[model samples]
Target chain A: MSTAFDAAEFRKALGAFATGVTIITTKAADGSLIGLTANSFNSVSLNPPLVLWSLAETAASLPVFRAAEHWAVHVLASDQEELSGRFARRGIDKFAGLDIETGVGGVPLLKGCTARFECKNAFQYEGGDHIIFVGQVLNFSRSESAPLVFHGGKYAHATRREAPDAKPRSAALSGSFNEGFLGYLLGRSHFQFFGQIRAQLADQSLSDDDFYLLSTLTLRPLISTSELDAGLAAVLRQPSASRLPALAERGLVAQLAMTAESDVAEYRLTEAGRDTALRLISAAKAVELEILERMGAEDGAILKSLLKRFLGVVDPDASVLWDDPTQVAGKIPGSGWDS
Target chain B: MSTAFDAAEFRKALGAFATGVTIITTKAADGSLIGLTANSFNSVSLNPPLVLWSLAETAASLPVFRAAEHWAVHVLASDQEELSGRFARRGIDKFAGLDIETGVGGVPLLKGCTARFECKNAFQYEGGDHIIFVGQVLNFSRSESAPLVFHGGKYAHATRREAPDAKPRSAALSGSFNEGFLGYLLGRSHFQFFGQIRAQLADQSLSDDDFYLLSTLTLRPLISTSELDAGLAAVLRQPSASRLPALAERGLVAQLAMTAESDVAEYRLTEAGRDTALRLISAAKAVELEILERMGAEDGAILKSLLKRFLGVVDPDASVLWDDPTQVAGKIPGSGWDS
Candidate 1:
């Protein structure tokens, strides 16, 4: 059967079954620590507490595992990718310079895993080029951290899928936007997010555009009109000239002395503006904390990472708004902006 | 060793190791199809292409599987959750009204899965209360579809995590906005998204606020001032009274006849406004397609779903902007808004 099958294709097919990463560890008879990363670990029985993992017959740790009375499986967490890679290497002291705990039969246990299963080696079966070791679980512990996933020869993240019943709402009328629209989602999210901070803005009698201007002012001590326009280009459709005068009149911003670099003139957030911006920002951060709490930390991280990537592709030059205002002059040429 | 361990606790610990869902199927001696969802499936060896899965000894299909000479494992795709659940249940015809393909030894193979392995049952081991059956794979195939993940007793979606080296850029100065900020991410994403369609707005001689007004008109035939204000409140900070007259002067919007129900008149898109908006929307959709293409389809869906969830938490009332204007009056009270 093996002679007829393509080994590479077989391996590729096996990779399709995504598995949580695990570092199986044990102690050699000579008292040396031994471990290797494997995704083949799986639970076999609950009543008798059995779990199993297989190791290549030619592996250096195979002899150690075969002679060991016990071994432990550390289910890697999303943050343990480096540890997974460390144990996967050859001819290296995987446990050197690390904290470890001795489990059943002195098997070294790695910390910060999603789960730790300490087991006594119970049975070994010949599995072609590998040996399958079934273990009787003696003790175990689990954590709430998200598990690290491996699929198609790459690390992945698993997000709790929304319930099937939570379907994307369709628009009542045709040609109207629905929840599925990326633009609608982005716009609505922005507005709703700002909506949380809007109370603070209202207290300060600042509008959405005013909030935008005020926040931009917080990015630097004194930003020239040209710099402000360029930085806020993607956000504000109306020019800063229209909103700045009002903020200045309200004493939220103050004009800076003309500089030798240019006569464009610059504006800085006044003391009151700084205090208001800080207060509003703290409130906004609180809103973010609540929203992220509801969305789960893992999903929230993935969402932000993806949004940054999307922004990278769509608005590569948009980051200039937050970049050092002085460096903006040199970055303008390759900023990928047509203007 | 098992006597002291709680079965439920052990099972909970094992659940921490996420596994892709699989439906194992085999033909009974009577030629009847037998299938059940299992997450115990794992690759055992590469040389002989061996894979293994454990079945509870008490399972009704245990005898059938024990006697089977061949079986198939179907690694499910993310979209196959319902099929997974259907096969997980007992006392029902799991194969009812479905297309099925026969594999080795006349074993039934499920369709639309991430991968499939047809194998010859080669070995069985005593695994406490379960039987671990090892198979020598004779044939297998795989698809690029994202695998269905099972973790902590629920189905999940796996998204390719960005490499750890790709960290978010930190702010140049402390206490300033960077990619880590949700408001910055959302604002940048929205602006950059609209930036793609800004050219169309420019071609139509429309300002950003004009584009917003024109697009809002596309939602309904007749939008009242109050409805428009409420709907676009998070978006447009200025009163609709200021923007409406300007739009009407430009013939992009028109004041409808005042109704007996309310003194406030309604407005709708003019023919030119509708045409411009439709054209701009088509352009925006193209940008969306390009963006989604760059980001894999699965991640794109997950990101949008998460953003929608986040919006649901922060601004539950924001959806009214897209709701039918006629229905707005009745929904205002419970719209999760103070006004």
Candidate 2:
């Protein structure tokens, strides 16, 4: 049964306990700066301000760390993934290009971290294949930046969970829509967000379809009737057959001569249309700012990220209308369009 | 400068290092199970299999842990927040109602964890105000559940970070919509999601507005014209005046006679309309399952939670239409409606 003690399985089990990424740095006896990435760091005691991290005995820096009288632990921020990667590699100068500061006993310190601890080496204990170094804190500092988390052997982002009492409101009747329904949430979010921009539309005397058509024109200097139809098909039903001519009638859009010898034609936004679209877009952005500010910055980032991923899953080929001429040409052979 | 090392500040600085929540449990000599919440656990070695965690020397269960020959570490799942709270409390039977199992040397093992490690106590080191217990892991098991994280002294949920190279596609023209724009993301997600269910709507020979009206009817047995207008004001510009009549013409909706001496009228779905709505809703739910499965369960959960929170911010009062009778009564005077 002793053979059942698989190291890989043991390591995988240990990975279940998530921890923040940290880089421990120190000055060696040979006067060279040494640092390595580690997540084994933990607080051991508070009364005497003791913290500990283990270094593998087989590591190249083990001798340096064992002899060091002082060292510093830098608790990385959410945006420091590159730094973590740099420190995790070996046989290279990790501090070569960084703006480094000297901590207790001239130990190297990295900036832009969530927290930093300068400590004096106190005791070392044997931990089988590793050596555990316990340090007495000399000084420490912290910032408001969110911490970088490592979980299941990969980097992760951590967001504050909703309060236990903040459960989703249920629908009054069975089989009815509720706050938990994804469709209801998406529809409500889209409508409520656009609700703020509708006032600007009313002021400009532009209908919702008119606004959609004008925005499509702004995506390119001139959009073909087929392209417009394909782009706005999901929302406007038949944009070219209906809304485009209405916009042209109002002098907000102008029909362009077809460069090819075919009945197909293109449309471009008039100066008024462009100006109106820009104005409304700017106003919509302002509303977005107000909403995202209410949602915490971290949550806002996460929401946008997940939404983009969702779009990637459901609309992988929906970028045709927004593609540059070069990309469009690549996708459609012999189009000859160049950006 | 030593005064800067105040316990509270030091504690706050230490909390900058995020960690996964865990409960290390062991059996006392008297056959009582002892478990306490901790975030101090960390992997110390691979060969010979060692892990360590610190416990306050003054803790009530320290004696039991000190004399125990075996213990188990349970890495908690995201759904175990209540269990974490229960174990973190003092002087109570934490496992009184839990479905527990006995591990190596009869240590208590909790179910429904991300991972579990059974260990033999190998060494105990003195750590100022605490003692560090290092264990040699005997055997372990893991599950695919997402881990529960702790950061900044609060419970957190961990989400996988986006791949470094998956940047949002840029717009070809300046001031045009890109994949990163929140409005574009929301609209595209809404339409693409609905795009999948549109085929079901087509089979029923119903337009988008018709489907929306029919679904809204299912929220209540009968809805007043004014209430329909208020509920669908965002999507359907004039549902009662336009779409409701169209559905009524098709024999899907029927107008109800006024029971009171008022000019207001109400509408309800016919048997045909109700069946059509149920079929369409079932199809939509199937589409939701497909999309969410592609999004990964954890991310899908996070996305829906964030969307609900966003609605809470922008459309807090949007629930007026779906309010139960009691809430409606509180909202409107003398409407004798109750759930």
lDDT of 1 by residue, B83-120 (tens): 99999998999999879988878999888898899989
Fnat, 2 decimals, each candidate:
0.69, 0.68
**Candidate 1 colliding pairs:** none
List model 2 lDDT by residue over A112-161, tens digit each. Answer: 99999999999899999999999999999998888888988888888877
Deviation in angstroms for A264 in model 2? 2.8
Q: Each prediction's Cα lDDT score?
A: 0.82, 0.82
DockQ of each: 0.47, 0.49
Q: Whole-model lDDT for model 2 versus the true structure?
A: 0.82
- Chain B alone: TM-score in each candidate? 0.85, 0.88
lDDT of 2 by residue, B1-339 (tens): 122768898999999999999999999999988999999999999988888999999999999999999999888999999999999998788999899989989999999999888999999999989999999988788887888999988988888777665433544455665555677678777877887788777886788778778888888888988888888777675557677777888889998977668777789999988888877877777777787887777788788888877776666666357666664444533221111
The candidate 2 chain B region of ten consecutive residues with least summed lDDT is B330-339
- As a TM-score, model 2 comes out at 0.89
Q: After superposition, how far is residue A95 of candidate 1 from its true place, in Å?
A: 3.7
